[model samples]
Target: MNHDTSSEQYILVTGSGQVLAVSDTAQSLIPHISPLLPDLINGAGEDTVLLNGRTYQIHRHLLKSESGESYGLLISLQQTSAVQSSDPRLGAIALALSDKLEINHVLENVVRFAMDLLNADAGALPIYDPDTDRLLPGHLVNLPVDLIVPVIGQRRGLMWQIVHQGSSILIADYADHPAALPELVQVGVRSLLATPIIYGKTPLGILAMYRLRNEPFSESDRELLQAIARQTAIALQNARLYQRAIRNADERFALYQASIEIGATLDLEQLYQVIYRATTRLVSHQRFVIAIPTENRMVEYVHIVTPTGRQAPQQVPLHCGLAGYVLRFGVSLRLSGAQALPEPAVQLLPEIEGELADGSLLAAPLIVGDRIIGALLVWSNHHDAYTMADLNALELLAATVAVALHNAFRFAQIQSQAITDNLTGLANRRHFLQVLHQEMERNRRYHTPVSIAMIDVDHFKQINDTFGHIAGDYVLREIARRCRQQLRDVDVLARYGGEEFGLILPETTYEQALKATERLRTVLATTPIMIDGRQINPTISIGVASFHPTVYPDPSSLIADADRALYLAKQQGRNRVCGVQELTNDAQP
Candidate 1:
């Protein structure tokens, strides 16, 4: 077995399996043969092994001298198959695929590398389409642009066979294969090789290479193509996950920006603008509408923005329209095509009927706690234009909008309570003084005349004693209402104190103030407030005061003068108007 030692490649290894010497022809095979010495020495016969993409036959024999004692093992290495290591292009392609973040770019690189490394004339990367249950062309190299590759399915084309079996296939003669499509044969494809692009247990697509001549693909070619498909699968999966992560980050940022911008203002109009700008970042809409529930159980359109212009606010029943449906159920909705325009929505939202007829719609309830306060509605002019992602983004924005609106409404309520009287719905005493101070400051600066009046319900204590406090409150409320109806829009009316009211008339003289007070007195006296079943006539005594630079320079002095005139009117009789000038002339020494 040891004849012609010069022609055979041999490795000398110690009994413990470490290379001690290698023949001249075996030097190149040392690295591959050294690791297999232990297994060859332990085995009783010759064996074959694969190394560096090449097959080699191993023969192990005891190295003995004249004493017939074993000191080392002589491993005979004989070349079997001529397959070499992976093509250098595979390494470059792996590097290129690692740098790509887009799926299409990765697929293209896979096809190009497979065609160049395998020496194929044409190649294609077809992605699996779950919707069609087929493989669709993703990227093509040296393939006709208009050539339609047949879809991959069970017992179908070469690509389908590879994907279905989860293995690489080498069709040495595509014409002899029963599953070969005519389109491929017509394209002058004589041989083809396909490998399934698998990620984990799932098949993502197929990487296929075609040759125009009858050159059969080698085993190394099949192995290299499969390796490229594996790399391509990993690249594509990574790209898809990276894209999803980016989208999620963008969505979160949009919601955060919307919260900040919308919460920046308490003004209703400015709030609407911020909401619109923030929402446009996530989804574009042809029309935007905000509807809130009214006290009468009706949904009122508080804001509406369309492509043309904003519409006037209108009220609709709570059971009407898509917005109403979301409000009633407290659920989000995404409707497209025919379902976007239901009969109820068409009947209630006639203004937006055209938008709903041919477009898509998304709506989410503005919920605070367990209550559905309102609804946010958006419409687009394209059918099925919105996805679940869009709906989710809108819902996030809706939550922020609802919270902002709630805060603004609460702030308005608190501000109203701070300035208004709870009983009569007029400005309170503190606000009245503030307004008077402002007006007096204006008068002092510009030397302009401003008038003030004090009105008191005559004999209010007597009415409270006779008819009870309830009837007295009724009288006061009615008198305040009637006096308010007599004032101009520029005039300020306030409940100065219990049973007393104050009025500020801008740009009015003493005579004009007297006339206005007289009108308020007559209105109160003429209107009898019916309390419980009795008609009670109420009279108001009014006093007018004018701001003069030399006479009443300060707000307190002006108020004091008005009060003195009111005392004079009350002393004379109720239901009368008296001026400060008349009182001052009477008090002259």
Candidate 2:
């Protein structure tokens, strides 16, 4: 059979496949349509088929007598691609889209090209978002301001029908379609054509065209629009991949910078700030918070960013709240839309007021191996605010911060061990002398008075010998606790050696030192510590000394005066407070 590229071919055949008539254009294509006549007559009104090397659209028109009984069929065949290939706008659209790598640019070109190709009054290409289950307006042409719907679900209207069914829809008259947008009908939109944009097995979105005149869209128009939409899907896929690559590169750089700064930081506050900054690079938010668990099983809100005067949560039960949930399970939590917020988060964060109940939240645990150290959270007021990609970015930031926090904790443990007494959890002897020397140097420059006291546990050896070393350790611990409770925050209490403790009282005179020291002596002796169901009454003798610029030459002299006072107190009685001022001049520093 020969083909005619000049015009559409027409063939008239009976219902039983007998030829009745043929157009001059169809004379050359008799053999092509003869065998397919029976199938073509029964097929839906319009279809496309490949003949030889050209794609042809076959339109079936039923011929009936006056009684409406079908007798013959008039079939029309037109080459689709070959005819449209001659249109210069098709070439221009192809060339314009060849270099577009951005999603917005690709969408803009696709819509404008569709409008130009169909000579429609306006157009729009709404991109499909699977996360939100909606088609969001991507690009529009010649539409009035405030007319486009903010969002359209995938189950309503012509555009959504095509989205759900993966097919094309042509509404020849706006008033004829029951589900047509009333505003569009009122604005004199005569027709609407929508087709799903698909790439292989994936559906990207819809390509919709609008016409203002009474002229309806033909099958050729639907075929052309569907073809362009499928091609646009490929470009859309490329643009998304490019965007993800660029975003990933940026996140990597932020993590690298944060690692360098955090590794050099030993201060927890400074490290928190670095983590916050690094997180901002990955996740945008209206509020940011960092929470860590306390010894009492509570989540302490260590850092928070919120509006002024809003009572941010400082502490809450660790087994409650969203932050606790993240840390306890060591998993990431992402909540989108206020309507979908979990009831438990709302109930736990009741004090957070309206903010927590009406926002999207994302929380990732600061975990090292199987241990959860804390949690990082971000919040936004908008519904559907975060996606899986956003959550993944947060998880990456959490991983980086987790390592830094672990190292910081290890460093603090080491530093504490070096200066702390393991037996009593007080300052050790070396740290005590170091503090005494520092105070003396500072007082010497300012001419301020500083005082010191040396305390000894009376009859400690007898108690230890009778009760065993474990009981002795318990008594020492109890003594340190009582001394710490009675001392001022400015004073430094330390285990000096064996059974002696040193206390530094800054700016205290002889009188103040004696009163404070005597109180400590009374508190320890009055409260009998019960250990393992046995009452053990313990007593301490305190020596109070003050810094006099002319009398005490250095830290050692001050310490010596305090020790002499202690020896005098022990000799006079077991439970008493003695002052250096009361000592003989020969015995004083």
Candidate 3:
């Protein structure tokens, strides 16, 4: 155990157990064999120890040779203080070593240093998985490599306790501590130390060590682990941030792909599926929903995905649940745990009882400019598992999703708008023409009778001249409503033009079309237009024409036949239904 300082390898040391050593030719030391000097008498080579923080092997040597003739000395020595750095720049360089060094090399050095400091059998640094809330054993020395466990959120094990409480857990004997969960004893752990790796306020789980010897974990041992955990926190946090950024970039690329697919997808089901899959993958959630707000604080779930991964039917009172809270407040709620939630949230958890109580939740308010158009709810099974970084990433995704869905709904609205009469809330002239074309085609294809009716308000221009245009508009809207009320759901009613309205009737003969038109005229005559608290009666003239495939050749023939009947209605009287008879041979003149 005689020490050898003849080689200029050992450099400097501190009272705080920090050592600095150097070798110009190589980066590390390897153990070698030599003699122990006992012949020099006087306790030579008794209790000297050599330690290195990096990968190194210790060697025992002698002070003298030739039959052990000289010394019996065992001088306890380590690196001395003169060569150590007192400059702040040296400290900064030391700090940046972890960034420059490969993680494998850093972890190897850390494990070796930890073992030397604690005199422990083994140690392992577990890298954290934020997605699964688990720790995977890594960078191990003299330990089993496969040990992994959940360390955050809902897992009630020792590692989770250390991480969630943000403190270290030291146990002299795992068998004796009542605080230790049952799983801890089953691992054959005699004594264990679990300390959190914290970088500022963020926790990166724990650096844990186990001893089979039942030796008590000491204050010095805890300090050594604490120092290592601090460094580990810095390294792990850096790695995590780098990984998260990479993941975000990948998610953005996927989002772009999804956007292109969704834009081209006319199938609503496929579009929603793409949305849900992308949402759950990017935001770390299992369930999602789209709820649209309606009148009187009531919100309807336009789309809902159950926790079991099935899509529910639409038009349910979705916002009456947790979704309603977001709509009423117009803000996001990230609930870590439901039992610790507010009263309004508690009130909203009936239908989603087990799901809400056991899951983490993030709701993003869908705002189209200044208005709260809807909301997106993302749910996970672990509480408080998401960070501000994850939330910010998801916020971008929510914007994309909201804009896409809003665009889809708007597209549907535009399709319907193309044919709608805005002022009267009826079908416009173009819609009337389209319907006539479709009806004529259907009749020709099926050889069935189709009816057409043309109705004009009686002296509508005179009425507009008598009353103001506003009153005329009000009268027109009233006539549209009465016409709509008198028709069946399958019937088509539209404002044909300025003073004209038209209807296309499927499976109706000429006689039946005339009867339906007369009823529409009667209804308009009885319906009073209330403008400025004054009531005015309105009348309408009607014309009816019907043809089967055997009679009219095309849509043009149907419109011409209907126009002739309309002329006859004007010839007979203003407010009556008139049907056209076929032109006789004598009437050819």
Candidate 4:
């Protein structure tokens, strides 16, 4: 066969690795290729050979004599200035990619590099949506308007075709192409090229370049674009993986914080606050509501926190609204734009009329075991503001909230039971003493007066003898209820023992306590305890003692003084009130 060795460099080598012939340009590269002769002979197609710090593209061909008998191997060399220019930018991009840990930053850098490398009028890097099988525009440069690529039944656009076929595509007459977008044509795009950004066999996205001039992309341009796409795919994939790792770490930290902060307190209000603070870190919202289910299959808004303040909680029937939907179905709902919500859901949530006008809603069910306890609802004032990632985060946060709320409720119930009297539904003796001690300490610090009252039924034994013990129990309950009515909300009332009661009135003077006890004495005397159609009038003797730093230094001393006054009240007359000083003088020898 004939050969052209003048314009291009060529080398002929015998099978034994002896140089039989050489072109003028080949002589300079012979030294570099000789040391790697075995590798050059074994390697097929084009291989890069570096000679004296310069890169050369080498191609190998088999030389033959007549009758197809192989005589030797032929090699050619071409200098790589095009590749050299791209090397620096590619290296810079690699450095940029390695420096960035954020996915968005990496994507922006890729789009900028691609645009500058191609010198196109505009460019875009659209990420592949695996679920939709379409490209969602990620980063764009100098685009007049937003571009929305479409995916038809069997005819995805040129972009999808390039990804589907795993090849680079160049459309010189893009305006006339079948898969060209109308927007692309209107924007004066005459030529375009799209290269699939791929990681192994999986396609990540596409890097597309657009030119307003009617010029066809050459084979070299396609190759360069493919090279850029490959680099971008690796960088993008690395950034995505890194970001995913970071998100996972953040989520784990948030859950750990939730476990510690939410579980730190048994108070329901404090638990709600902790959940609010923790969830705000994951997602931003203006309104947060926790809806708990009632025994009657109804859902009640147990907690509602808003930017302004808290709102009064209200209840609705099951399956009535969005929150009800989550509670009834035990699933999550993320709705963006008012149009996304059904007519029935809108009508059910009339209270949130202002928020629904132009807001996005994310709701998730709070489930513990098989029981669906409540639902978490968060609302934002922007349309389509929440993503699937945000919904997933809310679900995770809802889990932590559910466990904490359940524990807090149980703790509250246990606390209530511990300090309450079973019969009269009043504070027990232990609770009274605890409160008295605390109140005395507080009074000492603030230099405020605290009063205590000791009361006994005037004729409790006679009432039990006359009526049955059941009636006596009824009388005691009635008396406790009346006493509670006369005391302030801050006052502490306890069932001291059988037929007796104790009261700790904080911020009260001696005279105020006496007058309050007198009112209780009169009320009990006037009110009759009715049992089985029998009216039995009951009265109570009362004693009052006010805190004096010198005289009543502690809770026990105050109680003792009040007891002395109570004996005086019994001695003087039943259904009366007496102070500690009055009792001391009356007992003077």
lDDT of each: 0.78, 0.78, 0.64, 0.77
Candidate 3 Cα errors over 4 Å, as ranges = 1-170, 182-191, 198-202, 207-239, 258-281, 284-330, 336-355, 366-375, 380-387, 399-419, 438-452, 457-469, 485-492, 505-550, 563-589
Q: Ten-residue segment with the worst summed lDDT in candidate 1?
A: 47-56
Model 2 spans > 4 angstroms off: 1-86, 116-122, 141-159, 172-178, 181-191, 211-220, 290-317, 337-347, 350-356, 436-453, 465-468, 485-491, 504-526, 534-541, 544-554, 562-589
Worst 10 contiguous positions by lDDT, candidate 3: 32-41
In model 4, state the lDDT of residue 126: 79
Q: Model 4, 362-450: lDDT tens per residue?
A: 89898889989888889888765677878898898888888888888789889988999999999999999999988888877888888
Which numbered prediction scores highest in TM-score against the true structure? 2
Badly placed stretches (over 4 Å) of model 4 are 1-101, 126-137, 143-234, 260-277, 281-285, 289-304, 309-411, 456-467, 471-475, 478-489, 511-542, 564-589
Candidate 2 lDDT tens digits, 378-468: 8887766778888988888788888888888788889889989999999998888888888888888896777899999999998899898
State the displacement of the C-alpha of residue 330, model 2, in Å, after optimal TM-score superposition: 2.6
The candidate maximizing lDDT is 2
Q: Model 1 misses residue 124 by how many Å?
A: 16
User: What does candidate 4 score in Cα RMSD to the true structure?
Assistant: 14.3
Stretch of 10 with least lDDT, candidate 2: 345-354
Return the clash pairs for model 2, or none: none
Model 2, residue 528: C-alpha shift (Å): 3.5
Residue-level error in angstroms, candidate 1, position 12: 44
